[model samples]
Target: MVIYGVYIVSKSGGLIFNHDHNIPKVETEKVFSFPIDLTLEYDPKKVSVAFGQKDGINVGHILTSINGVAVNGNTTEEGNDVKELIENEGNYPLTLKFSRPKMTTNEKIFLASMFYPLFAIASQLSPEPKSSGIEVLEADTFKLHCFQTLTGVKFMTVAETTQTGMDVFLRKIYELYSDYVLKNPFYSLEMPIRCELFDANLQGLLEQIEKTGITNI
Candidate 1:
C-alpha cells in the first residue's frame, strides 16, 4: 500500500500542486538493481541529497538504507537516529538505497495537461450520456484515482494497484484545498498553489496516509 504522488490539476489544465511521497519501494525479485557511482550534493536545509547532473535518481527518492543500515523509521526518535547517521562525518563510501517515484515533475505536468483532452474524449465516446469521463485507470503496477470537483478542478492520486479508499482521500484533499488554498487571500484563481499553510497541511496529510494508508486516514 503505497502512494507515489498527488497531482492537482486546475479547470484550465494547469498544474497547481504536485506532491511526491517518500515511500520505500516494495522489494521484488523482478525489479532490476544497478549500482552507479555518482557525486551527491546534500542539502542540510532539506535533509535530501541531489546528484549533480545525474540521471535515474529524482528529487523525491527516500533514503531507505545507508551503509547496510536500514533507515526505515517513521517515528521522530527513529528519524532523529537516521538524521544523525546521515550527518556523521566518519561514515564513508555511503551505500544508500532509495525508493524513487517513476515520473519527474515535468513528466507529471505533461501528463496532467494531456489528461484534460483525454477526459474530454472519454466523455464524448462514452456509451451513456453525460459520462464523467475517466475515473479510475488501473494498470499492471499502479492505479490512478481521480475526483473532479464541480468547478472542474481534479484531484488525482497515484497509488499501488491494491490500495483502496482513494475517493475518500481525494475528498479530504478537496476539503484541505478549499480551506488552505481557496480561502487564502493571496491565492490567485487557477494559479499554481504556493501557500505555505497548504503545503504544510498537505504534507502532514500525506505523511498520515503514508503511515496508515488511505483507509486509516
Candidate 2:
C-alpha cells in the first residue's frame, strides 16, 4: 500500500523527524503509539520539516494534541518544556480524530498525476547555466541540477557536473519537485506546462541575477 507520512530533514543527511498516520478507521476511538525514528546524527535544532498530506488534503488543521505537545504550522513546538517531552521520549500516542478519512489508491494516483506539469514548467523556466556552473557544451547538451529539478522536468540534453555537485543538485531537485509541484492539485498533466506565477517569480529572480551581472552561473 502507498503509505502516507511526513519526513523532515536537514541540509545535512539527517532524518531528524518522521511520523506515519497509519491508523485504520475502525480504530479511531483507540489510541496508538508510534515511534519517532531519528537518525543517529540528527540534530533537531537545524532541521526543517517537510509535510506531505496524502494527496494534498488539508490535514494541518486536523493535527492536534490531547497530552504531550503538538507542533502545528510545520515547525516543531519550541521551548525548554517541549525538549523535556523529548527527553522523556517513549511510546507517545497522540489521538488523531478526523472527520474525513484516508484516500483510496485511485484517488492518490489521480491527484499525483494532476500536479505533474508543475515539474515541467520548473524545468522550462530554469535559466541556462554558464560554462562553470551550467552550460550548453554543445547544441544538444545542457547542464542542469536543482534548477531543473525544482521545476519537475529533466533536460533533453546531458549535464556534465563533478560527481559530488551532481549528486547534491539531483537530490535537491528531486525533493523540491516531488514535494512542492507534484503534490499540488490545480496542476494537471493533460494541459501544457505554464505557470504564470512561477514565471513571474522566476523572472524576478533572473532580473536580480542580471542586476548583479551574474546571469550565467
Candidate 3:
C-alpha cells in the first residue's frame, strides 16, 4: 500500500496544502483500468488491480486515453472531459492508458483546484437532491479518497488500491487540522497551512503510519 501524497483544498476551491511522499521508482510502461460506477448492472469490483512497479502505473502518470478516445490536458477541462466520458454508461470495462511523467508541484495544485468545480458539478448533476459529491476515485494503480468537512474543507489522500481504513485516517487528519490549524491564532482561515505544530503533528502521524503500517489511525 503506497501513499503517494495528500492534498487539502479550501472551501472555495483553493489548494491549502500539498504533500508528496518520497518513494523511489523507475519509469516503466504499463496499462490498467480506472474503476468507475455506472447505472448499468456491471459490478465495479470486477476490475483488476495494478500489476506492480515493474509494469504497473502509479502517480504522476498522465492519462492519455479512455477506451479508444484520446484525452489531453491535465487541467480542469481535461478532468471534466474524462468525467463526462466515464459517466457514459456505454463505456464499460473502462480501458485507461497512461504515460508516466513526474507531476510538478504546480500541476498538483492545479489538479486540486480543478477538482473543486468538478465536485460541485457532480452534486448539481445528481438526480437525487442534496447529494454528496465524489468520495472515492479508484484507478488500477491508485485510489483517491476524499473527506469533506461540514464547513466545506476537503482532505484528500492518494494511495494504492490495497490501502485500507483510509476514511478513518482522513477523519483523523481533519481532527489534526482542527486542533492545530483552526485553533492557531496565527493561522489564516482558508489559507495555506503553515503552523509549526500542524506540520510536526502531520509528519509524526505519517511517520507512525510508515513505521507501523497502521493506516487505521
lDDT of 3 by residue, 1-217 (tens): 6677888999999899987775445333333333432121112311112333324555344555665555555223234455555556665567765555556778878998899999999889999998889889899888999999898999999988898878887887899999989987877768898878877888877877877775435
| Candidate 3 segments whose C-alpha is farther than 4 A from its true place | 22-24, 28-101, 213-216
Q: Model 2, 121: alpha-carbon shift in Å? A: 24
RMSD of each: 9.5, 19.2, 13.6
Better of 2 and 3 by TM-score: 3
Q: Rate the local accuracy (lDDT) of all candidates.
A: 0.72, 0.34, 0.71
lDDT of 1 by residue, 1-217 (tens): 7887888999998788898885455321111123334343444422233553234455545555565555544212235455555446554435666555356678978989999898889889999998988899989989999888899999999898988888998999899899988887877768998878878888898889878777777
lDDT digits (tens) for residues 24-70 of candidate 2: 33211224355333211113432211343332222322322324344
Estimate the TM-score of every prediction.
0.63, 0.22, 0.63
Q: How close to the true structure is residue 171 of candidate 2, measured as C-alpha lDDT?
A: 44
lDDT of candidate model 1 versus the reference: 0.72
Q: Which ranking of candidates, highest TM-score first?
A: 3, 1, 2
